[model samples]
Target: MSDAILTLDNVTKVFGRADKPVYAARAVSFALHPGRTLALVGESGSGKTTAARLIMREYTPDEGQLLFRGVPLGKGDARALRNYRSSVQMVFQDPFASLNPTHTIRYHLERPLKLHQKGLTSAQRQAAIVELLERVKLDPKLIMPKFPHELSGGQRQRISIARALAVNPQVIVADEPTSMLDVSVRQGILNLLNDMKAELKLALLYITHDIATARYVADDIMVMYAGQIVEWGAVNKVLDDPQHPYTRLLLSAVPDPDRRFDDVRFADELGRVEEIRTLSARPQPETAQAGENHFYRPFPAV
Candidate 1:
């Protein structure tokens, strides 16, 4: 995207010895644009969290770089780093663990305003907190004074979203924001994200293993496997007619109410799971386009 607020340019993060390297992220590249969401979909060990950590600056890239608004990160001075921190906010996976049990929702939202949004008077900060709470669909009057422990899973997650918004961040990296909540409330959170993206024009990086939710909330999608982005494009194009074998493998696993146990396509993909994993792990720099917007790495030779 030409107007991407944040871009990962050929970023790589590795662990273990140089001779026997473990690739957590290998040449991963994508962009997050304002008012749109880029979903990173993968299995648990497929380097999804590693990518989030890279953006959060909890772990530095072993190769390549992160570009925030066209400027390379880590090279800038402390003030630039602080600006990056406030601009890129993270909503973690677990709402229960992300917030303090003792802290009221008001406190959680107030702290960020005090830090990043300095110069707000006490009354102004309180108003800002109320606005944030309302933005996330929480009733400020009822929610502000309640401790994290008093809220339901979904409400606490809403508070998490409110807290992230407190900094007036341009980008939000939500790592499985709805996974812990009941399936009934998941859509509410997703709707809130979509509303925030449209109304506030915030760029969103939604990281999840759930294909159904990805299809619902994302504008674009990247299918990651074995530390590499094997396929990516407009969400409907990529998910409707997946090109990569690994991408097909993931779609095969999603429970289909209409698909029978003896469905041939399901059996075929599931049968090659091991083979697909083995081949997908090998580095494939070559790319192939399936459609105008859909693209994938060509499957390696067996």
Candidate 2:
């Protein structure tokens, strides 16, 4: 983590009334290193999007610091903020809604390049768009003229990836990048993300609830519940030997072809669902190491 391009140090974001606050994120800390992907896995309303917003600078952390290359973000001059903005890019979940309805795909990719990459001439910018399209495995000639609506879900997601890469960002915050696409196409998109990370040496924060896909793409994984990362570490280590109850619950929920529907093991776990959720939701400051690269925050005793 010493080579982290972006680090969130005990970042907290709160909402609702001062007297009765809702903790969207509470002391969430993680680092995104170059050429590695950190998958943040959780169910809906688990504060995954809140963490993405914090990284994108869409929401400022109320309690902690966001550091880019070891310097606190937003504390520097206007130019520094602009540079930071350019360095961290986001690929939203809803590909259809993320792009402009009125503009062509070329315009979507061109706008960022024209803004962040200034020296390129009109012809050069156009060529750059083609290269980006090609990089994402799309046929530039066939796709550039079409608007976002004209493309399928997978294609639009690729365009989103292309646009993020358009700025040559150091970190890519992909929030459920494949959830909206067809099941068949999900692997392809995931492969593209993996390819981009390896080729560009980009630090990726792939946020998703899909543990299956997280296992496929991530070098490291963090399991988020309520607003805290209850378990985290090497992808295989954590997934294979999940320490936190919430983490185990998530893994159990994943479909197993070999197991029957009425299996007794998962049923037993499901019986204590409420108890597990309640305990996991409580703030636990203590962390215990389960392995050299694996750790979990122990739930307070009931």
Candidate 3:
């Protein structure tokens, strides 16, 4: 994590009341390194989107700090804030909603370039836009004139990716980039994201509930529950031999052709779902190293 582009250090975001607080994110810490993807995985209401929002500056942290390139991101400095905004970009979950319905694909991609790269002339901006379209593997001539509605779900998602890349971002926070796409096209999008990370040397935070896709694209993985990262480590280490109960619970839920339907081990894990969740949600400040690259926050003693 020495070369982290973005770091969330014990960051917490709370909502509701002081008397009965709701922790959207509680002392959550993770780092995004250049040329690597760190996946944040959990079910809905598990603070996955909240963490993304914190990085995007949509929700300022109630506690801890967000660091950009080893410097604490402070709100007081206007120039620094502008630089942070330009450096970090996001690809939303719903591709259709992220793009403006009235604007052509060209307009959508061109607007970011016009705003961020103001020195570029109109002709130069057009060329840059075409380059971006090609980077996302789209035919610029055929897709540029079409509106969001005119493209398929997969194409629109590609446009979203193109727009995020338009700003020449150092960090790309993609929230469930493949969840909304057709199964047939999901792999293509995942492949494109992996390619972008390697080619652009971008630090990526890929958020999703799908462990399968996370394993496919991510270098490291974080398992979150009740707003806390209960377990995290190298993708294969965490997935192959999950250390935390919640991580095991999640992996068990994924379909396995080799495992019998009446397998007793999985059934036992499923039966204790509520019990495990309850224990895992409690504040556990203690972390134990499970392997050379694997670690988990131990569940608090009852």
Those runs of model 1 whose alpha carbons end farther than 4 Å from true positions after fitting are none
Positional deviation of residue 29's Cα in model 3 after best superposition, in angstroms: 0.9
Question: RMSD for each model, in Å, please?
Answer: 1.0, 1.1, 1.1
Instruction: Candidate 2: list runs displaced more than 4 Å.
Output: 75-78
What residue pairs clash in candidate 3, if any at all? none
Expressed as tens digits, the lDDT of each residue in 148-266 for candidate 3 is 99999899999999999999999999999989988999999999999999999999999999889999999999999999999999999999988889999999988778898799999
Task: Report the number of backbone clashes for model 2.
Answer: 0
Which portions of model 3 show Cα errors greater than 4 Å?
77-79
Local distance difference test, per candidate?
A: 0.92, 0.92, 0.93
Task: Output the worst ten-in-a-row residue range by lDDT, candidate 2.
Answer: 73-82
Local error of candidate 2 at residue 137 (angstroms): 0.8
